[model samples]
Target: MPAIVGAVKVINVSASSIFHIGDVYAMAPKSSAKTYAGGGSFNTGSGIHIQLSDSHTYVNDNDKFDQTIIGT
Candidate 1:
């Protein structure tokens, strides 16, 4: 069986604006804890950017996944 891999990213706003403050949070299964890709709050002239990915090549065979993201 091949490993299940994927990635996700989110932002609070998607328009031409400035972010005075921003925050981000992400989490994954304990078994694949190391698979947590880099993600955090970023200030942008148009909006905030959050990037996340799953780099684990040995993930389980399951195709189901759960993720959480909090931003402000």
Candidate 2:
């Protein structure tokens, strides 16, 4: 069968996430997190340190995978 789509709108899409329209068989999404640290030299013994964090979910694997079963 077929579909008649009209006025399709997509707001936003992020990494490691998927949005399908018609049909999908198999989906395998993998994501990871990483942290970075740094130190700075201060004149006084007491100092405040801050670390910036990353807020992105990147897709590690992009394999669609194999499908065996189908439906109508």
In terms of TM-score, which candidate is strongest?
2
Candidate 2 whole-model C-alpha lDDT, 0 to 1: 0.57
TM-score list, all predictions: 0.15, 0.36
Candidate 1 collision pairs:
none
Please write out the lDDT profile of model 2 over residues 1-72, one tens digit for every residue.
Answer: 655667879999897687777656787666656444334323256556656464444456556543423231
Question: Which 10 successive residues of model 2 have the least lDDT summed?
Answer: 34-43
- On the 0 to 100 scale, the lDDT of residue 46 in model 1 is 68
Candidate 1, 14-66: lDDT as tens digits: 34333432342543323222233333533457666655564333446464545
* Every model: Cα RMSD to truth: 21.5, 12.8
